[model samples]
Target: MEIKEVAYDHPDAVELSDQVQAEYRTRFGYDDTTPLRPSYFDPPRGLYLVAYENGAPVASGGWRAQDAEDEGYAYGDAEVKRMYVTPGARGQGLARRILAVLETSAREAGRIRMGLETGEALPEALALYTSSGYTPTTGFGVYRDNADSLFLAKPL
Candidate 1:
């Protein structure tokens, strides 16, 4: 597996984003509608990372700077987004690898915490974060007040 940093609109990255949304539609009954700008993932503020297996993108995730009061944000809250691993790549730790990369990159970029909003349907994602030190928190972001939403935070 190769972990590579890329622009959010990079061809491969865009492809994976679509794939993630497709899965999300099936799992959550709707696709995420939040606006995502490529610049949001640029360094000095945040980053986007993709993991490739045999040259095929398998997993991806990114974080962007957010004020403490902003949705999906808390202390050091660089809001995590688009975290996903392809079905064929499950159980290989690719999701965790991408997550660690996001956390480390965000910390190096001067962030002190990480936060995210996920839906209840994504047990795998919640499990990954919980086992990696993320603790339950209140909901924010597009899913705020949504009964099926789950929020988590971690100190970087």
Candidate 2:
């Protein structure tokens, strides 16, 4: 698999994002209304990455800088987003690789921490993040009030 940095609106990136959200919608019966502006994944403040195999996007993820008051986390937090690997890509370690890239990129960008919110519906994601050193934390951002949301964080 090859990973490429791309804008949030990049065709491949958007396709994967939509596919993942569709799965989430079907599993949780809710839509994620997180405020997502392309600027959130713009360079100097954030980044998005897509993993492709044989010219098809199989996985994607991104990180955006966050503020303290609103993020409910420390300043310089890089909130992870849209982490997904297609059904066929499962068990191939693509998601973990993508996550490692995001973490490294966020640290290189001067972020002090990495934060993310994933629902219990995705057990694989929970395991991936936890095994990658992320620990339970107070909920933040869009899912802050969602009972099903499981918040996690890791120091960069």
Candidate 3:
């Protein structure tokens, strides 16, 4: 698999994002309503990545700076978003690869911590994060008040 950094609104990135949102709708009974903008993934602040296999996009993930205490984020925090692996690409370690790159890029950008909000419906994701050294953290973001939401963080 080849992982390439791309704009959050890039065609392939948008395709994968739509796929993830569909999965979210299936699991949560609605699409995630978090407002996002392409610029949020710009360098020096954040990054967006796409993984391709045989020249077809298969996975994606990104991170954005988050430091607003009112939103429950810590200073120098980088929040992960839109992590996904296409159904056919499952079990290939693509998600792990994408996550490692996101963390590395965020860390290099001076982000002191990496944070994300997932949910119990995504057991595999929760497992991946926990095994990668992420631990439970205070909720934040749009889903903070949702009982199904699970927030996790790891110091970079």
The lDDT leader among the candidates is 3
lDDT of each: 0.88, 0.90, 0.95
lDDT of 2 by residue, 58-130 (tens): 9999999998676576788999999999999889999999999899999999999999999889899999999
TM-score of 3: 0.98
RMSD of each: 1.4, 1.0, 0.6
Native-referenced Cα lDDT, model 3: 0.95
Q: How close to the true structure is residue 38 of candidate 1, measured as C-alpha lDDT?
A: 98
Model 2 C-alpha lDDT versus the unseen true structure: 0.90
lDDT of 2 at 66: 94
Worst 10 residues of 2 by lDDT: 67-76
Pick the winner on TM-score between candidates 2 and 3.
3
Per model, how many backbone clashes are there? Answer: 0, 0, 0
Model 1 C-alpha lDDT per residue in residues 1-156, reported as the tens digit of each score: 999999999998999999999998999888988788999999979899989999999889999987747654665578899998989999999989889889998888888888888876998998999999999877777778888788898988
